[model samples]
Target: MPEEIASRRSRITPEREAELHEAVLDLLREVGYEALTMDAVAARTKSSKATLYRQWGSKPELVARALRCTKPASLREIDTGTLRGDFHRMVELSDNAQMAKDTALLRGLAHAVHASPELHQALRRLLMEPEISGLDEILRRAVERGEIAPDCPAIRFVPHMLIGAFIALPLMEDRSVDQAFLAAFMDSVVFPALGV
Candidate 1:
């Protein structure tokens, strides 16, 4: 379990906490972070504001908990031996079909993170840093396997490239990351750039 989960489990019943967290996610999707209030979450979860306050302490912390709960666990560990296998696993894990359903929730999170420095820092620590570390582990393994040079520019930039592709394509063209695109990305950009 994540450290956050272990810490939070001691504070509330598991079922009740799940219900409250789900309510927060629902509200984030429907009303967005800016409009979602502790009172609304309390009413939705049939809990009191005091309960929320006693558990989460603040709106950003509650939102962070909701995001933490909702994120898919598939990307937690992916070590496929070879670089290509690892890259493919990463792409498969980041399926556009899965993400499409959560576009509203993602937008709400972006808005909230942009508006608050504290929330932004929390997001960096909770979401971005861990994912980046996972990717870096894959790259390190690739380096050990002799698939790429130790100092390869592509290895260094791979995480940003992959995430940039995800963010840019959706925001710019409003298109999903299809298999054809993934193939081309791997063939033309990723592999060659990595000197594979």
Candidate 2:
């Protein structure tokens, strides 16, 4: 039955899929991940709950894939001859409004992630791991360029530093994380720690 459902879903057009995914994100923003339901998604997207379940297997997977749709361009593609330049280019690519929305969504999901192992696993696999690998690649390139030392202990903490700044700025200063904030953060905090 699952295989049959999967086969049927395969025939779904990319446009339709994108529409559904966007609906899911809208719902997530409106009600948050814990309050989000397949029934609500069905109504919002004009899709069947059975189809949603069959297409994604579970709530965690459905939510993860929906969130994945909102991901920015792959970080691996960023190469600006310098790590600082790459980081700045990344800032340029970000839309401040979209970043704020994503931050709020992540804050809402953070609590639910602790209570639901399936959700945590799904997000880690479908979303987090790819970004982590991208960060790793960026750091590796920096090391190769001698911009950062190969044995820099701060290398592993790069994501933490970035995510911390993203999550902390609004809480600490009641300010949205715009490109200016990020650029300054890179210069004052991240770059100094990396010894770049």
Candidate 3:
């Protein structure tokens, strides 16, 4: 490695970057995307304003990077032999605290995403695509297993339904997403939608 290359690269460690990302998400949850600031994130992470600006260039870059950090570390282990089993595992993975955290961040960003194209693309790439891909994989497997027909048009909407239910839960009932709700939802909605 060249000394000049090493000198020009960032000094922040991966763990430290994760700390900053967590701070950004937490602050986004508290203050919302439109209201969130580099100053607040700096204060929360005990980082200097100059360093953040230097590293990320702008608020969108930083927040987008933070949201990317929040995605599952990898594609979730989805093998459960049955589509219902897989859906149950995916929903159970949400738990209570994580669901609330994600919901809060999403709720905060919902308004702001429409205004900022960069942020909108970031949310789509970092927050949405992975979950969508996971659902596609699950459905693909179910199709292969003959649990459902390959030509079913309803298959495409499953991911949207899963995410929609999460977003609507707070609006419909003043409550947080938990395993019990997910379990019942799988029985009532997800199963029927899958037609299995």
- Top of the candidates by lDDT: 2
lDDT on C-alpha atoms for all candidate structures = 0.77, 0.87, 0.78
Candidate 1 lDDT over 6-90, as tens digits, reads 6755788888888888888888888887898989998998888987886777888778777777666635488878988877876
Instruction: State each candidate's clash count.
Output: 0, 0, 0
Q: Is candidate 1 or candidate 2 better by TM-score?
A: 2
Clashes of 3: 0
Cα lDDT of model 3 overall?
0.78
lDDT of 3 by residue, 30-50 (tens): 778888988888888998999
Model 3 off-target regions past 4 Å? 1-11, 46-57, 71-76
After superposition on all C-alphas, the RMSD of every candidate to the true structure, in Å, is: 2.8, 2.8, 4.1
Candidates 1 and 2, the one with greater lDDT:
2
- Tens-digit lDDT string for candidate 2 (99-176): 888878887898999999999999999888888898899889899999999999999999999888787887898666
Question: Per-residue lDDT for 45 in model 1?
Answer: 88
Off by over 4 Å in 2: 1-9
Model 3: lDDT of residue 186: 79
lDDT of 1 at 3: 77
